[model samples]
Target: MASHLFVSSTRSFSCLSLILKPSPPLLGVKTLFSRSTRFPRTYKPLVRHGSNAHPKLLSALSSAPPVVAWKSSELSSARDDVVILGIETSCDDTAAAVVRGNGEILSQMVSSQADLLSRYGGVAPKMAEEAHSLVIDEVVQRALDNANLSGNDLSAVAVTIGPGLSLCLRVGVQKARKLAGRFNLPIVNVHHMEAHALVARLIERDLQFPFLALLISGGHNLLILAHELGHYLQLGTTIDDAIGEAYDKTARWLGLDMGKGGGPALEELALEGDANSINFSIPMRQHKDCNFSYAGLKTQVRVVMESKNISIENNPISSANSEDRRLRADIAASFQRVAVLHLEERCQRAIDWAIKIEPSIKHMVVSGGVASNKHVRARLRHVVETNDLQLICPPPSLCTDNGVMIAWTGIEHFLSGRFDPPPPADEPDDAMFELRPRWPLGEEYPKGKSEARSVKRARVHPSLTSMIQGSFQQQL
Candidate 1:
């Protein structure tokens, strides 16, 4: 039987509940601190000493080496069931969670920067970093409190260390390093995109390796083939701006609410308008490659808005007359339709290319913040179904950045023995870890072995192709 440790905190007493079975015991444990409060408590080891041991046991114990403080190396060798505290500040949100080895999320907490979006128009890296610095400790403590566990109980610490704002990423990496050193836990540095992709497997057990993944977010637009744990085959990516970024820009131009993020606000406004009211050109219609380009579409929207004399500043969408509001909605709807169509074209090509490499690939996993968009999800679902593939998307909440995904990814990596040693005690926080603001998801497609060759031989379902082409033609 396995032992369970539950650590709960209260004003009067901090309780540590332990149910131990016959097994190798933890040794030489010392103090545990509640960082939220100033109080520190000490707990002695549960092992019996000297006279309490039987004669043979006493003889064996007397000859054994003295155990000092617990370290990650010792912990890994003693236990397979690990608990991870995942911290994520790779973007505007500060989030943390505690997850167990068996894909169970014990507790999760997120501190969003929605309040700052309106003031700054969008995420200002420095302001976002400042916000993360302020709330990260509280968010992490809340997660631990909700889980009824302490740092000492955690087997490892995981953090999103790359492909984000340099300032924001540093906040999370610094916090993770501090916890790893204090708790003597192994550290796992997770790739932000990989975490987004692998998190699907946690929610759907049937989701396996070598499936297609479409990761669309504020910063990324990627279509990849997940070959296995920590390995990916890149199929397509955005050549200019990501789809989510375009959504934000358009929303800002149209004066959509920024409180819930521009993408969601625009998505909501789009529902009220006719999608065909104003036809936006589908981007990259003539490009044969799977690579995406959204800059052209963004320029087109700007030009059209200017030509119509639409002023988001003088007459905000919230306070506009009915006629202006209708026009705003129409623009939102038209832009969303064309944006999703671009995704459909790329996805159709990607699915065909992927099947040639791995015929067993039958699921399309779309994730990231933009994947939470209802319009994006509904359209992508149609695209996947048309290709005879099941669509797997994490719940809208999980689609955005969260600690649960990072923790879950850590669990996968931990089980596979992929980890790094904690930072040296003498190292400075700034120098401890490297942050990749522009890290590619994996290696780019090789020159000679590009998916383009396979794409040439692969055939897209005629109905899907015609449906997409017809939509573009109607817009034209």
Candidate 2:
């Protein structure tokens, strides 16, 4: 069975019946004037229904003695030059970036927890949260400074809200909310996996809707058919541990350097060893579906380690004898070969499935942390090319978690008028946030839906349920 975690869902658009005098319109601008009790008689009106109002307008309303009417040209300009600041703290990295609507990445900053991962062998959520807290402010500030802009200059503040560690995600979300509130900017809540998929669009301007995407990362392996922005049909997902998790475990067991995370270290080590040295079996050979499973392959490596008496406790890579090191490298080579073969096989099948449903799909986007692997990219590129489809892989920098993707995805949603209103600047620190640590990107295709749907649906947070349901209200 597959699972999902959501970040932001549709905000309620319920009509409020207010009995008040009508205000004069300017340039066909329709304003919904409302008094903020917390900020006193200041008419802080959000142009929810205005022909000239730009959805991405930044600090359009002032909280002073009187409300100012924005000119139509100003709103049009806002639409043309939407600037967004995106913050991401989904796991072990604290990342931020500033991007313009035209796909210009002004600045990007990432504070990686490499040392922590090296010491702890993996990310400890609470510890990761602390690390994010320590560097998040600096990272965001540096991104803004490098971009040569201030918070008020941004049209909206975007942040990854879910499909990550709750503790770690809070650091970024809280920062975004605070910044948005302080600057009176709209908030664009983003999904982590969605950002990974959509960031390819930022780089490839010609990419269009109804495409195929393979999102592979530390915690997820998903095959989705993107019908359009915010509309997707899930083709497949991991049935067990993700490929990145398997790589990390394999790297640790092999006593390989984990300073840069396991996937890259393993990929580097595989370069020296022969790929055909080990006879490890590929996973799920009998399963014709697109879903993935790495647990069995991981177990196979464990058995090999036990038989070879390669104990990590006694032999770190630095102290290992030449022969033992060679053996480890061979294992790395073999493991990566089969692991990627699994991805290749699933992608081929997913393409067949996706093409049947959406014949217009001409591209396959491969992205995420694992997608940064050169071997993975080359192998998948071959698969895509053979199917007569273009392969759209973001450069390695964009493949990994970063703020640019979030900002770009935010811009997509904002243009569609899908965003939340500005949060109150004085909101209490203890206020609850709308976080989705396990939100699904989209519904499973009926033909692919598993019996686990009920179980997965039951685990969703009530607030997330309302938002997700509201988001797909059109589908309903």
Candidate 3:
């Protein structure tokens, strides 16, 4: 039984009610204060589907030979009342929520800057930062109220901490730190894309790691190896525009509404369009690396739109004619195909890479907005069948951004003891608050990235392993 309650300040967040054995559940929270903490990372952090927290979490923490004040289960309610305060200012939306450690959502409030950015077609970074600055406090407060909880009621604070616009990340982290300081709660830094992959596990923790994860989101195209909590091996990444970016640019070229760019709109348009209308060649099918390229497809859409005399430079995308609409749909179908093809090819490469590293992977899972695309989803299914890989994705809605994913990620981390002391803020490396327009997934090398390829080849994880794999291979 979860309900929404507000603080006297009109703040809203969720309250969780779970049925636990009448045992004293400890509050197991870990904190990471710096980046160079050389702890041998383990398990892929994600919730078990329908099971509030992972059963293996407690066991993993017990395995952690560290000293933390209390285990979450030890300090938690008899019903295992675990609360996560999550903030998502990754992009243009300023969102905050209080969710149960389980899959239940208590209160979620998203203050969208759609109207503000609609005139510009896409989000402007400074504009996004300003919007977050104005509303994050109110949003966070409301999430707390909705959960019928206060800062003191929270077990941990989770914020989207990486691979996002730096300016925006700072605003969110700065505010969250203040709150954590006030409450003296452990703060967890979450990877934005990883949260997308783990949201499905919150509802289906059975989707074990050592599987493949094709993460396609706006600004990110990654092939991750999920071995266990705090562990992911990024097989390869986008050499250019991320798949969702291609969709967004294509959608904009076809004059889709602002804030409703490529990802979601592409899904809708593909449904009404023909799959075979315009057969576009799949990108990088011959490429050996697990990387992808979507810039070409995005440019193709632009040229096709201009060649067909479709003008999208105007407002109100409804301005197009029927002929333009057909062109848009066919183009959408074709573009979706290329994107999926790129993803499938890369996913196969990751599988092969994993095979070389660890050969006992149970299957692969994908959970992100791109995974929500029927075409992408279908392509993943085909790969699963052909390669004998397990294809998993969150339900359509969960594939995109949501507070539930954050709460779920928090639960996973809390259980694994992959956290540090609840500091005043999530980032002890406060200097890292600067936005990184480019941050490679999982691994970070020096200017020697090119030279590291040969080394990476040698470090590939075994593909078919019964045991868990780590997040990234650094030896190569």
Candidate 4:
């Protein structure tokens, strides 16, 4: 996922035999010259097995160049068609899906760790890994079954490699590697966040390259310019906590149900309170840069809850006291308002900055978990409309982590010939491969351009703004 380019110059080889020639003893040790019969004729000697060779030198030589071998039939079939099986264990879910080259999702399956949420209150990495391990095989099998296909029918296998919990990511990566090796399928490593941003293309075929993307999820808050399938230019990132983190924390403090996750729970509760009942300032209003900060806003909400003596024990809104319920809803509503405003501000700035870099940019694709919020979507719709750009967001289900997105991203990369050979059958189960847990989506902000040029904030139609502000008033 971290490296998009696939160079096939190096391939794994099956060793048939080794011949060793003994040499005169040196330093009370006999030296040996070794050669493998399977070595390519073009192979040149780089290191020899001698008594003087250091252990580290031998370790380095262990990773010799792979011998390339491909049957004519296999090569021909490979070029005919591609259907990818994508696995995603990048977070709290175990998911697998089958997707064809033409952006059709043949089958999809997901096993979420919602059970752990009630017990642990949040994602427990080790526990989440165990959950993934328990259900991954079944999930994959179900996906294949739903598609009426099997491993043999798949052209390649893909899995999220990083920018997620390392423990959880390993479950998906290892499972995918095993399937690829067993089925002799090429592997496409997928970046979790990149998959989120690109999945929109599948939904909106007219969406083109050089569009702007605002990726907001539990772990990420980013505004990137998608120049191409594997290229991006980051314009802004969260300076502190991600927007979803703020939402989750606020939800927990507000005593919202943990079953549906903090963001969704808060969104539901916010609908019950007047958005204008409590005022929460938008973050980074003074800073014209596109960067975001939600920690301050989160702290502000905590302070307000403490001052108002808001009880977070066992869903305050459902308690016997009516006024207590109203207070909780008010906090949820106020928090949602400011959280979405920050997104609007940064998205507006990102749109202006991206237009300068690529004038043809006419669409803003919003993805990731937070993008599923109706209020957030409404506000962003207004932002893009004011700027003469269309806003594209995947459906609510696709906005969350799922195998469909990974599979689609894999299809995109597979078409571009970005893939790696299947792991050898005899490869150890614990063999090390490139798995980045903290990979960046693309290049960071360009040097000397840390701050985007100031752009006037897009003006929302007063009617629309008033409607949102007054949304919860009627409920009260």
Index of the highest-lDDT prediction? 2
TM-score of each: 0.78, 0.83, 0.74, 0.77
Q: Who is ahead in TM-score, 1 or 4?
A: 1
**Between the candidate structures 1 and 2, which one is better when assessed by lDDT?**
2
lDDT (CA) per prediction? 0.73, 0.77, 0.62, 0.72
Better of 3 and 4 by lDDT: 4
Report residue 302 deviation for candidate 4 (angstroms): 0.5
| Residue 48, candidate 1: alpha-carbon lDDT | 26
Q: Write the per-residue lDDT of candidate 2 for residues 29-137, one digit (tens) a residue.
A: 2222111111101233443324433543434432212333546566445545566889999988788988877677788888788888888898889889888888877
What TM-score does candidate 1 reach? 0.78
Model 1, 117: alpha-carbon shift in Å? 1.3
The C-alpha stretches of model 1 lying farther than 4 A from their native spots are: 1-80, 425-427, 446-476
For 220-302, candidate 3 gives per-residue lDDT tens digits of 77777766655666677766677877777777776777555457776777676776777677776655677777777777677
lDDT of 1 by residue, 1-476 (tens): 11112232222112211111122222232211111111111112222222222243223223322232234554333223456889999988888888766567788888888878766788889999999888888888888888877876676789997778889999999988887777656677788888899889889988887799999998888888876665677778777788989999899999887877999999999998889988789987766656777888998888878888897564568788898888888889999999999999989988988888899987999999999998888999999999899999999878999998999888776544345655554567557457767666654454213332232222212221132234334433
How many steric clashes between backbone atoms does each model show? 0, 7, 66, 1
Off by over 4 Å in 2: 1-79, 450-458, 461-476
Model 4 TM: 0.77
